[model samples]
Target chain A: MNKQTIGFAGLSHLGIIYSAASAARGFSVVAFDPRTDLTADLAHGRFPVAEPGLDDLYREHSARLTYTSDASRLAHCQLVFVALDVTTNDSNQSDLGPLEKLLAEVTPQLAHGATLVIMSQLPPGYSRKLSAKLADNKLRDNQLFYQVETLVFGNAVDRAVHPERIIIGSDKVGADKVGSDKTGSDKPGEALPAHYAAYLKAFECPTVLMRYESAELCKIAINCFLVSSIATSNTLAEVCERIGADWREIVPALRLDQRIGTKAYLTPGLGIAGGNLERDLVTVQRLAEENGCDASVVTAWQRNSMYRKDWVLGRLFASGLLQNTEQTRIGVWGLAYKQDTHSTKNSPSLALLRALNAYSCQAYDPVAKIDAGQFPHVRVCDAAEEAAQDSDVLLVMTPWREFASAPLERLLPRMRGRKVIDPYGVLAEARCRQLGYQYERLGA
Target chain B: MLQHHRSPHSPLPRTVILGAGGFLSPVLQRNLQAHGATMMALGRSTIDLTKPGASAELAAHIQPDDAVVMAAGLTPDKGKDTATLMANLRMAEAVALALQHSRPAHFLYISSDAVYDARWSSLLNEESACEPSDLYALMHVAREKILGQACQQARIPFAIVRPCAIYGPGDTHNSYGPNRFLRSALNSRTIALFGAGQERRHHVFVDDVAELVRQCIGHASTGVINAVTGHAASFGEVAEMIAALAADNIMIDHLPQSAPVTHRHFDTRALALAFPSLQATELADGLRQSYAALQPASGLAALSSASPASQKPATKKEEAVCP
Candidate 1:
C-alpha cells in the first residue's frame, strides 16, 4: 500500500511534534506554519518547543517532512491535521484566534475527498461549531472532523508517536467512507462511517469514533476526571496526614483498585497547571450552567485546585515565614506549572510568587524569564543561586531537572534565611538537615 | 507455610504496624499473626501524623523493642496535589520523630518508585539517587532521610523498602499495579493504556511485600532496597493476561501519553541480599491469585455475610469536613 500524505496546519508545538512523528512513521508530512520566520527557522532545524528527542526526530525525518509558510502545500495531502496549541488566558478561557485563523486559511485549500482533523485542544463543542460554520461555507458535512490532541509539552514526541487513544468526532457516514477507503473496502453490512473514525484511524491509534459533541466531551471528560482526582488527592492528602494516615500508602492501594488506578492523577503537587485541566474544568462548568446540569462537582474541583495552588503561600503564612518580616525576599525556582515546558498559563508557582510579591520576590526559571513588564515588583534572576541570594524564603515550586539536582552547599550560602519550602522536595532532607537548613516539603 | 504456635496466655511479641488501615495493613496483620507476633494496627482514625507534635504523641505510646513499620504517607489518589503531598511529608516527619524517641528495634518504611526521576536508565536499584518527580515521592525521600538520620544517631536498625507496582489478593482499592487490569477485567470494562505498553514495570504481589516486611523484621539489611519482582513486564502483556483470565474479550485501548514518561524498572538484588530466600510470585501466578481472590464468593464474602442492619453507612453530615 502507498503511504499517505498528511498535512499539518499551524506549525505550533503540537504541529511540530505530530508532523515529525507522522514523518517518522514513514508518512509524507507537510507542516504549514503561518509565521514565515518560524517556518524558516524550523527548516534550519530550530524548534519552538523544548521537547526531548523532537529535534533529533525532526533532523532524522527532515526529508519526509516539509516545513512551509504556504497554505497551498496542504492541498496535496490526503489528511490535514489542524494541530495548533491553543492559548489559554489567566481565567482559563482559551483564545482560539490562532486556530480560527489557521482554519480560515486552510479550509479554502481542503480538497473534496480530503479529511480535515482538528487535532488541537479546544473547548468542547468548539470543533463541531467550527465544522458547522465551515459546512455553511459550502464544505461537505463529512469533510471536517474534530480530534482531541493529547500532547504533553516535555514529552510531546512520545505522545505524538504513541497516543493512548485517538478520538474522532464527525458524521458517521463520512467517517465510514474514509475508514473504508483507508482499510481497502467495507464489508457487507459494515458499520457506517463514524465521521471521525476515518481521521482517527489515519493516526493508527485505538479510535473512538463518536459524534462531534461526544468527541469534544471525551477530551474535556478526561481532563475533568484528572482535575477531579488531583483536587480530591490534594484535599485528602492533608486529611491523611492530619489523621495520621499515610496518603501515599492509601494511594498505591487506591491505584491498585480498578476504580482508581496508578494512572489516575493522584500525585499530590502544586495543583493543576498548563491550562489543559483548568480549561476543561472551566468549559465543563460553563456547559453545565448552560444546560442546567449540576456543575457543583466541577466547581468543587476547581475550588480545590485553586486552594491547593495557593497551598505553598498558605504554608508560608502558617509557618510564620511572612510574619514580622516586612522585606521578606522569596526565591522561586520554577515558573512553569510542571518542568521542561515554558508555558506559565495558570502556573501555581506564578500564583505563589504573586502572593509573595506582596512583600518582595525573586524568581528564576531555567527557560522562562519572569517578565518585568507584567510584574514590575518581581526580580527575575539569571541563575537559581542568584535568585536565592539574600532571599528570606526559598520556594522550590516547579520540579525542574536543574532545581532537583542543584548543589545545596552552593544554594545555602546564597540564601539569607534558613527556611526552605521545597514542595517538590528537590533537596534531600538529610542533606538539608546536615546543612542546618529548616526544610519544609510536601508529604515527607 | 510453617505454622508456629505461641501459647494464648503468653503475650506475643508486640508489633506496631503503622498505617494499619492501609492496603498492606490486613496482610501485615495476618503475617504478624502467623509469626506469633502481637500486632497493633494503627489507622489514621487514631492518629494524625501530619499535625505538630504527632511524633512526640506517638512516641509516648511506643515501648522499647517494639517493631514499628512506618507505612504511612499521602499516596497519589488523583494526581499531584501540593497540599496533600505536604501533609504526607509532615506525617513522615512525625513518624521520624516518633522513631527518634521510641527507638524501635526495626523501622521498616514502605517507599514508592516515584522517588526516582526520569533520568534513571535501565532498572533503578536501591543506590539510585533520589530524584522524585511528584510531591509524594519527594516526601517519601524526605521521610526516608529523616528516619535514616534518626536511626543512625540512635543506633537502631532501619530498613527502607521501595516497592514498584504492588498488586495481589485482598486489594480493595483497585487502581495501582495489576489491580487496574484486574478491576477492569472484572467489570468487563475497557482498559485504556497510555503510550505503547513498552514502559518496563516490576510488579510485586502484596503478599510478597508482606513477607518481605516480615523478613526485614529481624534481618541485618539496613538502608534502602527495592522490594519488587526482579523482572520487568510490559503493559500489553499484563493487560492481555488479565483479559485472558477474565474470560472476557475486553478491549485494551491505547490512549495518548499525557503525563511524563515514567519508565520504571527496579533491581531487587538489594532486597534479595537483605532477605535471602525471598521469592517474588510470578506475575501470571499473582494475577491468577488476584483474579480468584476478586471472586464475589471469596473477596466480598466477609462484607456480604454481615447483616445489612449491622453495616451503617456514614451519614453525609458525619463526614469529616476539610478545613
Candidate 2:
C-alpha cells in the first residue's frame, strides 16, 4: 500500500468517493479536477453532493489524500484512474465530450509505465476508441483498463469502498499473451509486474477481469437487468392493484424462488427514473438502430418508464382529484429522485410537478438539488409542514424520512380536502382513511 | 455407455459431439461434464471424417433425445494449402451423411468468422454475405450449407455459430491477432504490430465460444448466430493492452503491413437474442485467466489429459512466434 500511489483525474462522484475510499484502505490518493473550486472544496473535505457517509470518509482519510487541479500530480503515480462521471443530456444521451477532454489532458501527464484505468461508466467501445486515439503514444493495452463503475447515486461511499465485486476490463498485451501465462513456457513467479500487481492487490475483493468492451457492456447489462426487473415489478404491480392483490405480498414468492432471489429489484414504485438506466437504454437503442437490429425490449423499458412516471397523474385524473385544477392547491412531499441523495436527473417527483404545472402546487424537498422553479409556477416551500398546509390533495413523490414525520395526522384536519396521494406508500393507508382523509397508493 | 448424469428437474440433454478434438472441443466437454450431462465426443481417432460413409455409425450412437455439437474442422493454418480443401469437404459430407439416419433434437455447427467478406464490409452479423476470403472459410461455408440442409430435412433444430478469432489457454493456433499479440507481449515485452495495427477484428475467448455452443444443446434456437461479443478491438488496442499488463517497461513497435488491412466488426444481436441469460466472459478476464493459467513453465500441461492438445494440438505449432 505504501509503495503504490493511486491517482484520480476527476473529483466528482466517482473520483472523490473512490479516492477517499482508496486513501482509507491505506493507499496514498491524489485526486485532481480541472475546476479549481471543486478541487479546493474537496481539499477541505467539502463535497458538493450529499452521499451517505461520504463526508465522514473524506474527513477520516483527508490526511493521506491530496486534492489538486493540476494534472502533473498524476505523473508520479503507479496506478492512475480516470474517474470522471460522464454527464448526460436532457434526452438521456451521454455527452462524453468532457470525459474525452479530461482523458486528453490526463494522457500527457501520465507517468511512463503508469497503468491508466478508465473508472467511469462510459458506453461500450468508448474505451477501445479512447485507447485507439492514444495509439501514437507509448501506452500499452493492458495498462489501459476500464473498471466498470456501478456506484448507486444514494450510496456512493459504501458502494465505492466495498463493492459487491469488482469488474475490471483489461487485456493481455505483447507476445506471450496468446497462451496462458502458466503454460510452462515462462518463469513461475509473479509474471505480473510489481506496479500492476500492487494495483490489483489493493482491490481486496473478488475481481472479474474482462476485455474493454465486455467490461463496458457489463455495466449496461447490469443496469438493464435492474431496469427490466423494476419494469416487471411496476407492470405487474399495476395489474395487482386492479386484481386486488398486493405487490408487496407477491414479493416474498418471487424472492423465495431462488432464481429471482431475495435481492431482486421486486419493489413496485413509479418505474425506473435514474439517469444511468435511462442513459444505457438510450445507448442500447442507438447501438441497435445503427446495427439495424431489434432493440424493442430496451424501447419497451423506456416506454414503460415514461408510462409509469405518469402513474401519479393518471391516478389523480382517475380519482377526479385534478378537477378544477386552476383552484386546486397541491402539496408535494419530496422532490429528490430517491432517499438520501440530492440528484434529481430523472426524479419522478420533478416529473409529477411538471405534469401538475397547470394547477397550484406547493413543493417541499428535504435535500433538493433540482430547482422546482422550472415548473414555471410551483411554490417551493421551506418545510414539509408548509407544503402540506391548506392543500386539496397532498402528493408524496419521494419517500424522504422527514416527510414521514411531517405531523401528517395533525395537518390532515386543517387541509381544504382530505385526499393524500402517496405513490410510494410512505404513510399507512388504513390510518389515513380512519383519520377521515382519503388515502391512495400504487399497486395497493 | 455415455458419461453424464440424470436430474429430474432439468435433465441434461444427452449430447453427441462431432469435432471433439477441435479448438472449442475441450472446453465444451469440460462444461458439459461439469453439468453431469451424458455426451459422446467423437474425434478423428474415433471416426475418420474423410472416409466414405464415415457418418454411418452416428445413427446407432445417437439417441432420439440427443443433441450434437459439430466442432470438427480444419483451421486456416491447417487448411491454408489447396491440398487440404478436399479433406475439409469430405469431413462436412461425413457429418451430414451421419445426421441423415438419426435425427437428434438439436444440431450445432461450429462455423468460422472467415465466411464474411472483410474487404466488402466491416460489420458482419447473421445477415452478412456468404463470400469466403480463404479456403478455410470456403470449407466452413460449404459445410454449413450441407449440414444445415441435412438438419433442415431431418426436422431438427440446428444452430450455426461463427466465432471470430478465438484465444485462450491451451490454444495451439498462434495467429497474428490476439494469439500472436499475447505471445509477443510475453516473449518479447515489445509488441510488434502490422503497420499502425488499425485493423478492427473480433476475438472471443475459447471458453466463451464453448459456452455459446453449450447454450445450443438445450435451446431450440435455429439459424446462423455469430458467437461474437460485438467488441471489435483494433490490433493496436490489443497490443497496447498486453504492453500494459506485461509492464510499463514494454514497448509497442509498429511495423510495415504486408497485407491489406481488413476491418472486421460484428453485431452480436443474434447471440443476445438467442441466449438472454448467458453471461459471456469478458476479454480482460479471459486474457488474465489465460495468462495466469499459462504462466508457469510448460503451463500448457496443466490441462487434464482429456484436452484436445493432449492428443492433437488445437492449432499447429507457430514456428514463427511473432512477425
Best by TM-score: 2
Proportion of native contacts found in each model?
A: 0.00, 0.00
- Candidate-wise lDDT, in order: 0.72, 0.75
Model 1 stretches astray by more than 4 angstroms = A173-204, A324-326, B1-323
Span of ten consecutive residues with least summed lDDT in model 1 chain A? A180-189
Q: What is the Å distance of residue A443 in model 2 from its true position?
A: 1.4
| Candidate 2: Cα lDDT at B11 | 57
TM-score for each model: 0.54, 0.56
Candidate 1 local accuracy as lDDT? 0.72
> Which candidate leads the pack in lDDT?
2
Residue A214, model 1: lDDT of 75
Per-residue lDDT for A41 in model 2? Answer: 85
Kindly report which residue stretches of model 2 are placed more than 4 angstroms away from their true locations once superposed. A140-142, A173-193, B1-323
